[model samples]
Target: MNLPEILADLQLILEEYQSRLDHYSDQVFMLSPEIGCWSMAEVYSHVFGTCLMQQKAMEMCMQGQGMEGSAGLNEMGDKLFALGHFPPGKYEAPEALKSRVQNIHKEDAKALATKLLSRIKSVQSEDILNANEDQRMEHPRLGFLNASQWVHFMLIHTKHHLNQLDRIERKFSMC
Candidate 1:
């Protein structure tokens, strides 16, 4: 997609996430409402952390040091944008992030998410846009991706979690 289209979709997804958050009361947002279920706060925190990591990866690519030159890796990146997400139950968070996931306060989640959204917006700038498309970085599971693919992955990743948030909202009757 072109820059405007990408930016619009990114903005749309971020707005949708914020709107979902708006529907939940503070108490409701904090409730898991089921065993092994994550609270809305934890969900937001996870998304925020993932976006932060993506941002760092983009920065690394700009520095000419993160590219791993994985063969056939662009196809993996294409599949992510095409499929929208990893198949449910088919992927797991790394052990380090597992413990970091927790029930953050509502305000804190909003702040983190807002900051991430802002970074998403910043990617439209010329310098970021012109970053080496040939540069690649290795993902733990999805394999190698270039700078634009990283941003696209952020969009696909947010979209994947939006569905989970919808179900959680319904489970708690917040939707």
Candidate 2:
């Protein structure tokens, strides 16, 4: 999607998150609803943390600080871009990343979301829009992605997590 479209979608998703936050009681925000599941706060923490990392990669690529002569997006990246979303499945966080989302308070999650939305809005320069595809960062699984792709990935990633948020809310309501 184009920058404007991406920005609009991102804003909508962030607003949705904020709306949920507005309605959640402290107990509901912190409840997991089941074993081995993330609380709503943890989910927000994880999404914002990942988006921040992706945003940094996009900035690096736009500034020509990405890996020189890097091979572009791999097959999976191509598929994901073509699909415009992640394929349906459960994805596990790496062991190192698991702890980062733990015990996140609602206020901390709100702060992270605010910071991320601000950073995302700041990347609308012409340089970023026309960033050189060769200046790319390696996604741990999706291979090298340039600035534009990184932006798109952030959108897809956030949208993908909305389902998780819905599920958590549903489970909480049932309890």
TM-scores for every candidate against the unseen true structure: 0.84, 0.92
What's the number of clashes in each of the models?
0, 0
State the lDDT of candidate 2 residue by residue for 19-48, as single tens digits: 677778888888877898888888898898
lDDT top scorer: 2
Model 2 weakest 10-residue run by lDDT: 94-103
Model 2 reaches what TM-score against the true structure?
Answer: 0.92
Q: For candidate 1, lDDT tens digit of each residue in 9-119?
A: 877898777767776789888888798888888888888887788878877776666765555355655676677677676345777776788798888878887887887
The residue ranges of model 2 lying beyond 4 angstroms of the native Cα positions read none
lDDT score, residue 81, model 1?
65
Q: Which candidate number maximizes TM-score?
A: 2
Candidate 2 local lDDT, residue 12 = 83
Q: How close is candidate 1 to the true structure, as a TM-score?
A: 0.84
